[model samples]
Target: MTRTLEWQVRVGLSEEDGTTRAEAVLDTGSEKLIGHGVARCNPQDVDVPVIGDELAASRAMKDVAAQLMKAADHELETVGAGPASGPVAPPYAWSDTTA
Candidate 1:
């Protein structure tokens, strides 16, 4: 079965200090999840700050992945019931965009 997902992202920055903020939203039609992050100063700046938008987006997707993995594992374990060992296969697999 194939699942469809919809997502959105927004980034903002502070004019004075160049602080950056990012927000991401993930929705699966039936459910929704959100992630927010911030970055301050420039990477080349003396203080050196983390890049918020990238961090936020990446982390958010990571969280979603974790959740999906856990759910898949649980389902597989339940269905197997007598799993004796060996590698637990992922319920689903996806590949990154290739050009």
Candidate 2:
């Protein structure tokens, strides 16, 4: 069965008092999910707005990913497939190889 599905995700970022906050929202037609993240700069560290935005956005996306995984696992269980054997692994595993 060939099926086509499209999901839309929107991310917004804001900064206040040296802190950056990000909100990511995913719309899957039938449902919507939202994830939030925040990044704060240390007083001794250099101030870089772009860096904070990057960090906050990445974290928010990570939150969304985790939510999606949980939803998938629950759906599988609902279908009698049972929950995953264990925690779902991230797309990439950390490696010690020096580039």
Candidate 3:
């Protein structure tokens, strides 16, 4: 069986030097961390470069993952009884419902 962990990413913006810079926030329940530095302001402020968006998002995700691992590995202690060692159930199965 496979288990899914939930996570969420939030984007935020701030104005600096007449241009809006983007930032990202990651929520993993146990830990919350702000990721990536704001993209450099554009010349016109209204026009945002494509490359910046990609870079900013990528950086944020990387940072979030790093933070999560650091917290999990703290003091060699396991959290929440540690990840399941054995598969709890088959990957996929179905029960008959037709009469």
Candidate 4:
């Protein structure tokens, strides 16, 4: 069977008092999920607004990914398929030599 599905994700960001906050929302037609993240600049660190925005946004997206994985695991359990052993690893890992 050939099927087409569309999922939409929206991310919003705000900065205040040297802190950046991000919210990521995903809509899969039948369901909606939201994830939030915050980034704070240290007093001694340079005040780079863009860096904070990036960090907060990435963290929020990671939160959304975890939620999606949990949902999938639940669905598997419902179907009598055992829960996943653990969270799946990322496609690649950072290496000290590559940095």
- Give Cα-based local distance difference scores for all models: 0.56, 0.90, 0.62, 0.90
Could you tell which candidate, 3 or 4, scores higher by TM-score? 4
Which lDDT tens digits does candidate 4 get at residues 1-99?
A: 999999999999999999999999999999998999999999999999999999999999989988998798788778978545766545358754653
Ordered list by TM-score, greatest first: 2, 4, 3, 1
> What does candidate 1's lDDT look like per residue over 54-94, in tens digits?
55456556665666566656777889873557786554676
What C-alpha RMSD separates each model from the true structure? Answer: 7.1, 3.9, 10.5, 4.6
- Could you tell me every candidate's TM-score relative to the true structure? 0.44, 0.81, 0.48, 0.81
Mark the regions of model 3 whose C-alpha exceeds 4 Å error after superposition. Answer: 1-4, 13-20, 40-48, 75-99
lDDT of 3 by residue, 1-99 (tens): 998999888976554554445667887787678876445655765655555666566666667667666565553345554343543333247754666
Output the better candidate (1/2) by lDDT.
2
Off by over 4 Å in 4: 84-99
How far in Å is the alpha carbon of 64 misplaced in model 3?
Answer: 1.6
How does residue 33 of candidate 1 score in lDDT? 57
Put down candidate 2 lDDT per residue, 1-99, tens digits, no spaces. 999999999999999999999999999999988999999999999999999999999999889988998888799888978644776555568965789
Name the lDDT of candidate 1. 0.56
